[model samples]
Target: MKNILQVVHFPQGAVEDIRFIKSTNMPYAATGDLFISCNTSDIDANNGGYLIARLDKNFLNGIPTSLSWFNVVWAKGYAKAVHPWDVTNQGEVYYVSGESHGYDWSAMYCLNSQGKRRPVSNWRTHWLKNGTEWKGTPASANPFGQIDSVNYSGIVFKITGRCELRSWNMADFSSVQSDGNGGTRKGKWPADFLFNSPCDPQNPSANSPGYTGYSPEACCPVWGLAVLQLIEGIIMYTWE
Candidate 1:
C-alpha cells in the first residue's frame, strides 16, 4: 500500500496568520526546504511585522505518527514578502523588504545564501533608501525578478513600483542602483550601495529608462494600482 502524504504542521507566531509559503532550495541540502510568512491582521495596519519560519521538506503518511521537523526562524520583524532569489552566479540570497518596522516604515534588506542575516549596521550595502519611506511597492516573494536589460542575470526588484530597484553583482554581492539622477553609470550601472534612486522605485509609475511596463517576470501582470499593499507578509528583521 502506498503511504498517504500528510501536511506537516509547523510552529506559528502569537496570533499570526500565514500569508505566503515557498519551497526553498538550499545550497547545502539535496532537497528543497519550506519557507513560510504570515501577516498580523490586515493591510491597512502595520502593527505586526511579518513572522517567518523555515521547515525541512519531508513528507510521510503511514499510520498516525507525530514528527518534529527541524525548523529555522529566518526573520522576526519587518520581513514582509520574504523571497529567496539567485543571481545566476550571485549565489542564493534572500531579499527582505521592510513592510512595517513601526508604522509602515518601508525599506529593502538583503541576506546571503547561507541563511545568514547581514548586519544592519552596514546599511551602506545592506539597506537602501535615504532613510525615506516611499512605501511604494513592498517587495513580496521577496517579490521581484531579474532585470532584462542587464547582460548578466541581474535583478529588477520592482520594475513598476519605483521606490528604487535593488540589484547586486553575483560575484561579490555588490549593490547596483538605477541612477534616478541620470548619473553616468559604470559598466554595470554601479552606484552607491544605499542611496536615493533617480528612477524612484518606491513609486508606482517608476519604469526607469531601460525597462518598459511592469515586470511580467516579477508580479504576474500587476494591475495599475496598489498591488503591494494588497499582499500581507511577515515583518522579520533585527530589533533595535
Candidate 2:
C-alpha cells in the first residue's frame, strides 16, 4: 500500500504555513524535503524565517512522524515577517518580506538551499508610463510599498539561469507640491492606487509629458477627483 496521509503539524516555535518542495530535478525534492515558513511564538525572537525538512514516508499506522534533516533558513531582519514566497526546481527560495527595515524592506530576494542570499543578475524590465525600460536591481526595488504576494518560475539555459517573478500589492506613495512661493508642500497618496501611472516622486504633475491617463488625479486630491482611488490592479514584474 502507498502512503497517502499528509502531516499538518509545524515544527516547534514555527507557525503560519508550509510549502512542499516540488522540484522534480533537484536532489532535495527527491528526498522529500519540504519548505516551511513561520513566525516564532515570540515575533521579536527570530524576526522571520523558514525551514526545510523531510517527512517520514513510513507513516507508521497513519500517524505522521517528526521531520528530519531540518534546516532553518534564518533571514535575521532582512526578510522580516515573511509574506508569500515560492521555490524553484533548482532549490532556490524566492520570498517577499512584510516589514520595513531599510533598503531590503518590503523587497524580494532569493536564498540558496543553504540559506544564503544569491546574487540576482537577471534582466529586469520595467513597465512605466514613460515607456518600458531597464532599471536597477529588482531585489530592493519595492515599487509597491508593501508586497502582498509573489510567484517565481525558474529556467536554466546551459549554465545561465533566468526566472520570472510576479507579485502584487497595495500601492501607496507620498506627494509633494509647491507652497505657491519657492517652498514645497508634502502629502501622501492613499494606498488604493495600484496601477496609476508613474509620477515624479519629488515634483509631481498628473498632466506631465508621460501622462497616460493612468496617473493620480492631478497629483493631489485637493487639486481634482482621485482617478484610481480604491481601485486595485495586478502589476506584475518579470525578471528574466
- Number of the top candidate by lDDT? 2
Model 2: which ten-residue window has the lowest total lDDT? 222-231
Q: Per-candidate TM vs. native?
A: 0.34, 0.36
Error of 1 at 171 (Å): 24
Candidate 1 lDDT by residue in tens digits, 1-240: 488555444355443665665544335544354445555443434444444444333332132233222112222233434422221122223344433223323434334344444333313222222232212222211122212211111122323343223332333223344456876332233322322333323333432223222222332222111112111223222221
**What ranges in model 1 sit over 4 Å off?**
1-4, 10-15, 26-30, 41-47, 60-93, 100-104, 113-115, 119-240
For model 2, residues 1-240, the per-residue Cα lDDT tens digits are 499556567665455456433331344333333444554333435544555443443243344366534445434333333334555645555554323222222335455665554545342323333332223335235353211211221211110011112111213123555657897533332221322333332332233222122332332221111111011222233211
Best by TM-score: 2
Q: How many residue pairs clash in each candidate?
A: 27, 0
The per-prediction CA RMSD against the true structure, in angstroms, equals 13.9, 15.5
Candidate 1: residue 19 lDDT (0-100): 61
Cα RMSD for predicted model 2: 15.5
